[model samples]
Target chain A: MRVLGVDPGLTRCGLGVVDGAPGRPLRMAAVGVVRTAADDGVGARLVAIERGIEAWLDEHRPEAVAVERVFSQHNVRTVMGTAQASAVAILCASRRGLPVHLHTPSEVKAAVTGSGRADKAQVGAMVTRLLRLDAPPKPADAADALALAICHIWRGTATGRLQQAVAAHAHPRG
Target chain B: MRVLGVDPGLTRCGLGVVDGAPGRPLRMAAVGVVRTAADDGVGARLVAIERGIEAWLDEHRPEAVAVERVFSQHNVRTVMGTAQASAVAILCASRRGLPVHLHTPSEVKAAVTGSGRADKAQVGAMVTRLLRLDAPPKPADAADALALAICHIWRGTATGRLQQAVAAHAHPRG
Candidate 1:
């Protein structure tokens, strides 16, 4: 299955796509950033981001999506912007009924580097090693996104049946 | 000068335009929602929104842009979506070299209704009264956007020069 993962930010959003089964080597399909100018107002930058995502989605057409859930941080301003970026990713996935899977940063770190507290460089190094790539993912956001997708494949493949059963049990009426 | 105002939302976005001068009534040159299907995914919906804004800009050639700054709400999901939508407006204005203005919800209400705590209905009524329109702006977002534009005109026209002076004083080198 091809999965798209996104690390969203107001100025630059990281996107990566992986195609393969769980535990098996996943091929990197594409990776890039959706960039917006700093001088542009938040609204305009968002539009540009959206446009970039559209182009990416058209090119890749991943079957599923994984995104990092926004966590509360001490900085209100940063939290606010992150939340907004998260919403954009969610909206993009939900609108298409793409079945979005959200992962916490720690979970992604653990899945990628076998440690919950791995730094960005650590995670990037592991991603490169695991993927057997010559170099680490250039942009931190792109590496993070790739890690998120890989993590989803690892976790989702194992618990796929359990989750389906739980969903059936919980939403029996629906 | 002409100013465009936008209120971004998930399903719909409110848009309005007004002549950017004192004593001019807020003109509803166009008022409508930017609709996106619930199943369309964020990328496609965003394209629709950009097309809507681009069309408006091309048609009106507004010299400035104004948007309502988002305030935190209990619904995290909604707030996030709104922020992305706001980003679209900001990018549109910034790319055109037109100064973009952001007004808080309270400030917009106070400017239009003389009370910061005014409800939506009250603000809608006041917008109609102030603009001397034949009817209330349809789809609350449109009215809210119009109010934001009006707020900018009221505040910016009087103090825009003063603000420039103060900014220059604070950053002499800049």
Candidate 2:
């Protein structure tokens, strides 16, 4: 399955696409950041971010989109912007009928580094290793985005399998 | 000038349109709420809000849009939704080239009732009095929306005049 992951922020929104599924090697399709001027009005900044996300969707054509779920408990000032940016990402993908999933920061960290409390350097190192890239993605945000996609793919596949198993047990084989 | 005020929330987004100027009576063009089911995902709710705001813009054709500025310091859990909803409102209006202004809750209350800390009922009563309505708009959010519009009109007009005056002084008309 192909998935686009978004590490949402008002100043620099990270975007990464990955193609992978259970027992398959992951491949990085693209990685980039969508930036908006801090001096711009909030509305104009949001519009710019929207356009950027739209361009990514048109180019990558991912089957599903995963966004980092923002917690209000984060930085009191920055959390609002993070939530707003994530909303834009989710809206863009879901409006196109693509499945949208939200993963917490801890979930992404644990999925790749086996530790929810892993530092940025650790997460970046693992993303580089998993994607087989010579170097980590330039910005930490981009690496986080890749990790989000990885988490979604792994978790979603396992959840799907678990559901199938439950269904089979309930009905028995025909 | 005609202005649309949006009191944004995840479940209940209040909308109000008012027509007025600095020295004239205010008229209530319209008032309503856009509601989303509690069970719907955040992205879906945001899309619904965008559509609702678009319809209001199409019908009212307000020259400007005024939205309540969300503060992250507010209720932790609810503030994120409010910020996201406000983003949708701002995006919809600004995309169409309408001037979008954000007024703080205190600013709206002060404009309507001459007090920054005015209670909701006080603000509602003033909205009813200013718009010459028989009753205050139902749902405090709706009244708060009208207050936002009223604040935008009064404050915006004054700001424009101040800027014009400064320009006139600098240029010195013959």
Best by TM-score: 2
> Candidate 1: misplaced stretches above 4 Å?
A1-4, A15-19, A27-66, A71-75, A83-129, A133-142, A152-174, B167-174
> What would the per-residue lDDT of candidate 2 be over residues A1-174, giving only the tens digit for each residue?
999999999999999999999789999999999999999988888999999999999999999999998888778768878988888888898788788988989999999999999999999999999999999997999999999999999987788799899999999973
In model 1, what is the error at residue A95, expressed in angstroms?
12
Q: For candidate 2, what is the TM-score?
A: 0.95
Positional deviation of residue B12's Cα in model 1 after best superposition, in angstroms = 2.8
Task: Provide the interface RMSD of candidate 2 in angstroms, 1 decimal place.
Answer: 1.2
Q: Candidate 2: which stretches are off by over 4 Å?
A: A163-174, B166-174
lDDT of 1 by residue, A17-42 (tens): 98878757878888878877878656
**Model 2: residue B105 alpha-carbon error in angstroms:** 0.6
Model 1: lDDT equals: 0.78
